[model samples]
Target: MKKLRKMFVLMGTVTLMVNFCSFNILAEDGIKQVSEVQTINPRSGNVYYKYKIINGKKYKRLWSADKNAWVDPYWTLA
Candidate 1:
């Protein structure tokens, strides 16, 4: 009976640890700082810099190093 109880306790502890670790990983994944714009796009994995047109349109853009072209702006300075 004592051995069985110990085994159950160990199993419960292992389950709890797994749940805690998974929760922490999910929590971390939810907290991404998109405002911290890097020189590269995280999704496309391309380097970019902030750019914009100063004409009547005044449209913003990003110069992608990999694509070698201007792309629609989706980044914000943080």
Candidate 2:
């Protein structure tokens, strides 16, 4: 049972890493369609634009046109 759990954990981690890498690549290649959309701060619930995903393991990525800056939504909330 313990070995099974360990195997599952390892598999899950590998799967996540692969998915993240693929997403990061697509984001860089601009293959994902990015458009202007109204988004709300998960914490503040404030609306914002220039939304985008930045590739990082520990940080969030967002581009705000109003502020003309990049922000990490995760850090903003948590």
Q: Best candidate per TM-score, number?
A: 1
What are the lDDT scores of the predictions, listed in order? Answer: 0.72, 0.65
Cα error of candidate 2 at position 29, Å? 1.1
The most accurate candidate by lDDT is 1
Per-model TM-score on C-alpha atoms: 0.40, 0.38
For model 2 the TM-score comes to 0.38
Candidate 2 lDDT over 8-65, as tens digits, reads 9999999999999999988887666668989876653333533234463343346665
Residue-wise lDDT of candidate 1 within 1-78, one digit each (tens)? 999999999999999999999999999878966666558646774755664555434444577777787675464432
Q: List residue ranges in candidate 1 displaced over 4 A.
A: 32-78
Q: Candidate 1's error at 77, in angstroms? A: 60
- Colliding pairs, model 2: none
